[model samples]
Target: MSANDLPSLLSVALLARVGPARERLREALGQAGATLVLEEDPNTLELQVLRDAAPGAVLIALEPAIEDALERLDPVLGSPSLTLIFDEAELAARREGWEAQRWARHLVAKLHGHLDVLPPGSEQDGLLQPEPGLPTTPAQLHADAPLDFHVREAFDAAGDVPADGLYQAPDTLSEPMSLEEALAALQPPFSTPAAPSGPPPVPVSAPQTEPPRVPLGDHSSWSLVDDDAVAAVAPPPSATPSAAPPPSDFDIARLSLVDLEAERPADGAAAGAVLVLAGIGGPDALRRLLATLPAGLATPVLVHMRLDGGRYGNLVKQMARVSALPVLLAEAAEPVQAGNAYILPDDVGLAVRDRGLYFSADAQGVQVGTLPPSESAVVLLSGADAGQVDAVLALAGEGAWVAGQVGEGCYDPTAANAVVAAGMHAGEPPQLAQHIVERWGVSE
Candidate 1:
């Protein structure tokens, strides 16, 4: 069926070895916006029963226990209208909380053909990303007109300052002081004010030295309700008045390459490999992505996602089931092949040579800095470390095609979001695969 003809709420058939995994799969599918047509244990289910239900998709929680039963339903697996998705039963049974919710969002996105799962950040992800016409730089935050208007408004309103700015006249002042004396007593100490009135006036007899301090937060006042810590929260004003400093302490200029080192690509280095870095919600993403890749991609796919359990052998097997390319666990001192997938751990890394790169156990992880940027590519997926963001961006600056995962399924997109924020490309796994094919062109 054409993509446009796909259903809004896909009818799904659930098959598993009748246990907690089946129930978890049922709930997860429902949460992902799927309508369950049939839920049955694959070991006891009949093929004709599944065919008669006519589900748009079939979700199989695979395990060795149900292997023979699944083989009996091979005919149904080949149906054009049916989309078969296999997930690990152990993973499903254990999935819970936010991780399960993230998986559900990605599943719905896959079924519905949309990527709207937002990153777990403030609701204001787009706040700093203003359109072209809007203010982008710090100096533009206050421009000449707005600053003049605000300063003049404050100065003009300062004349009508009320008696005893924040502190009221003490009920039992031992000295029974005058109104001016009481006001003076509360002046400097009670610098910040509250109430629905203009702020207490500072005597402008001498020229005001320090530039005006901004309000504590987004509120339109110089006061903060935090009584316990009286320390200043706002940054002190800069000496230069010609150009306005950043509105907040964080300057966007920090991301610029002004302070970074200048490293050129090696003179005669050849194209190395396609490197993928993922975490948290990455296994599913990697599985889906690897399944679409052609066998003769002619570039080693070096996957460097860390699994806490160090199940690299299991990862290799999982990827091999879906991948057209030969997926293998990186071995010590082995020559990196042209069209194979390597699941490299932190201890293993590439050993650069005159011919090409090789997997070396002696090396300390895959170092992107050692690769020729012009001939390399880096893709950051969910849960990728933000610490490598600077190095990746530097490579992008040197002509490497860099991309980040955008949309649902990527649970921790901290590194991915950082890449996208810096104007790098962002898309779903399949979209990125297509780009890879288009950019590098494929073989037989």
Candidate 2:
């Protein structure tokens, strides 16, 4: 089946273990546009009911305790047409903030077989599109044009003067007051009559003489002096002379050129390893790819899949069930070995050191561009994030063997499609597996 052939509405049978996890999964499936045809507990699920309901897909929230129940439902599991999806129970229980957003995206990708799941009213057609012509320039102000009515009225009012020429009145005013009349109204009336003023007194005669200066020698007690007293005092010296500590032998060797050369990885050896990046519909794709890999493959496999904090344990167990090689969660400071598949944790970064992989506590996590391109094989699987496309392309340009999952199986091919468009290898999960097997020359 091709991606174009995917059903618009999926009738899903949910055989999930009951808890907050099951409810969270149900909500996510609803958001992804999946119609729940039947919901039943994994413990009590019967093959007859599954046949009767006839759902297109069966979503199972795998828990460690439900292995016995799954074994009994082998008949339903064996159906070729049914798409079996296994999710870690604890991971599905996370339904808050960014975790909820990621869970919804993954759920939609798994059920709808595509990454472009938008909310009801968020369709591109509903958005306002820009007008086809150039934007209309704002109407320019004309300097030669007449002033606005209010501005002209303000200028005319200021210029209008009364007949006295001492006061200006607004054109709207009926009467204007004179400056003399306004001042006379503000002054108080003289109540008592003033006595007859005597004749003005004669101007006083003036005699001026210059004052004399005193000699500096007359004040003998006060003298000007420089601050030479402070310079006379000296700071105290140390009680004993101390010698510097002798340089250590260890420090001398560390600075030598031999030490720097020893740190680098050997030339002509495989500096690169296999890196697998996936998201939403990656679990099944990963399982299919891992199953075809030989037991003693030379290239070390590193997998980075988006999952909740506590889901790594369950994922390792689930992948081991179908993978031909051992699947294990990668640990910090551990060396990457051949034939074993390592699942990368979300909180750490993976790096190559001494020809082996090592993990660091980097919040940004493992970046694809940080790996050595000449020695690495990168597989872009289903549901890979679109944000990592550029980094993956850079790796391809640096001579890394890059492959992407294509066709119906890749529900979220956003990152994979980017790699394919850049002229890298493109194929389904099984074909990707075959490519890796042949590239590394595994004795399969």
Candidate 3:
């Protein structure tokens, strides 16, 4: 099916010898707006899912009962479509980087209009070789699609941003507040009107007590209930302006690049960019994060998930349905483009080819190995790249922007320290998009 033809919601059933990989499955399916239902018995698992949603749904049964479940559901989920599976060694690998890379690769493949399952056994298991020359991989498929200049859509998907630090900025449209105005706003809600003559005297209604101050949360909304009262009693402007300098606490800028900002605008109107990073054990968090991306940003998202090659094809189809941006897997030898995302293969590292994204075998997996060029912008979902965190920092310092979700592996103090230092000194945090706009001078 075409990318746009995919469904919006999905329910997955996971069964294995051990407790189902609820967390992992949730993370992956969450990206596609799917809900994962965990159950103890495999037979009951099917009934539970059927009650909630139809079989056209995706069923992910790991290693143990995968084959049996697929065989049983083949006829039922086939017409509407169901993904039955067997074998799930990928989960046991413990190599987070490998899993994330696998996820990206699978996404690319599905986007390119191919959904072949990975056959077991062999020198190379999941990689597909198209007949003669129809670009088998997802990246290659991107080159074949249409290309158009997407304006502010950059922040929605496809690109990288600094994944650390508290970025802050001023809100451009906010007007500057004077000492009088500030004082007025801080007064109690049911206070008497101030005199309109000379500087209004401060109110005094206490024997020895001060009015409590109310704190505003991150987002605060207020309506001008007494505009007439405010306008009538408002003090007149000073006849002669004071010689003293302007107040140090005025808000004049159109946009604020505060450490707490969540999104950055694109540079000018060039192509829009978005950075996607997968996290381990909790796809729900990532999915929630992705869902909040503003609509109409046209941000092309390149995701880095830690999945197996076997599920890559299905993953892409799944992600496309839920993600704001169109999802496509990266092919063995394809070019990247706007309006489409390139998911990297398990064996490949995200890199830049002709200024677009490309994927290649990571000869040096995770730490110490040679990955795609350092300057390539990428969002690492999870893995053991602590040893190479410095290299990532160095590259980001040079020019590339990198964001990543720490994996389940034991935290590396050195890696955390290094990354924190880099973000504080060099990289930008994941949420502050406005700060990114100012620092990078991107306009969208």
Candidate 4:
């Protein structure tokens, strides 16, 4: 489709298994003539998105597989509309963290380019550059050209060497000669060529001996005896002070990305995908958590959850029914299909590597201390033409889609707060509703 056509084409990458719903989605795409690309592997989805072409695309993750695609395709692809689909009854089921991480990486890859990283040499002021027509070659510049040269010249003028001496040149013999000839030439002609000029008439033999002694007058002797003599004496040792302590770690994080927008949606298409994460829950919770979102969110819902219990994904699916947005679960390492929810597996986590969601062998954990499961957030830019697009979603007022269970206990409310703080420290404002709830002490 043309670039313009693609934006309005209702493009979506469907990630779902073959089944009645899958077939139905395919039929719907066919009927609507939407540019729907069905991917069984998220890796393929990531790979298929070329940087320049992804701006108008949409991503529908019907299963966990979409994470793999996001990871693989992040580097070159842009963030697209994302949706997740799954059964509504499994609210308590554990979801995998890796899956959420993959999705986050996808978002990161898609939006990271938007970060306001200063170009080289821009951080500080007062850095000077050579004026126009100034010598570009180092050889032409003098070591002390601007300040010391003139001062040194003036000092030389006051010394015994006359200024005129600067203009004189040393004499040199032009012709080559054998040692004997050179010696003959130098011999008496060198007979000490006439003694050089310029010295005064002091006799060389005169000795520097003392003159006849005359005792000093009593006045000189009296001055010496009455003086208060001041002699130099070694001073006592002074006390040494202890060193000061180093700055706190918070000081470092403050210099980092605290409270910054890490990324933003590149276009309307991306805005649509961002809608999934606008509330404390997923597509299902849209109605209760928020009021009136833009039309982009209501059109199609994309789910990308990184919970250890599959139940949350199921709950989200149930809640999606209450809103106008469609919702479901995505599969692991599968291509995302349009108009469906994709759920991640609860056993192992997922990540976006290359261009798709790949299942990680590692188990999920929780958010603790200052570190959170930022890996998922870090990797999502895999195929993305943009970087940090996920950060932009919140800027557009849509919350982010996250599957917390990556570290020690990501689901704990305290852990959520830590993640939010970490994101804030990283300069990306926390865009997840759950993170906000934790920060504000809100509960369902």
Q: List per-prediction Cα lDDT, in the order shown.
A: 0.76, 0.75, 0.44, 0.36
| TM-scores for every candidate against the unseen true structure | 0.49, 0.46, 0.37, 0.22
Model 2 clash pairs are: 272-375
Q: Comparing 2 and 4 by TM-score, which wins? A: 2
User: Which runs of model 3 end up more than 4 angstroms from their true locations?
Assistant: 1-49, 52-279, 294-300, 308-310, 349-356, 359-384, 404-417, 424-444
Query: Over the stretch 1-444, how does candidate 4's per-residue lDDT look in tens digits?
Result: 223633244344544444454454444445444565443434444354444343333334334444444445544433324332322112112333453333233332223323323333555544677687855567566554686777888888876655764343225444665667655555444234677588768788898787899654333223233233422332233523345566665555446556664343222111122223221223323333222222223222233334433455444434453333344544443433223333334443434333333334334411111111221222111111122233432332333333221222122233233333335212112223334233322112
| Local lDDT at 79 for model 2 | 68
TM-score-based ranking, best first?
A: 1, 2, 3, 4
- In terms of TM-score, how similar is model 4 to the real structure? 0.22
lDDT, candidate 1, equals 0.76
Residue 129 CA displacement from its true place in model 1, Å:
39
Of the candidates numbered 1 and 2, which has the greater TM-score value? 1
- Which of the two, 2 or 3, has more TM-score? 2
Q: Which candidate number maximizes lDDT?
A: 1
**Per-residue CA lDDT of candidate 2, range 200-314, in tens?**
6655764355558854332333335556844454224433334546666665545645544344333322355799999877887898798788788777788888774446766
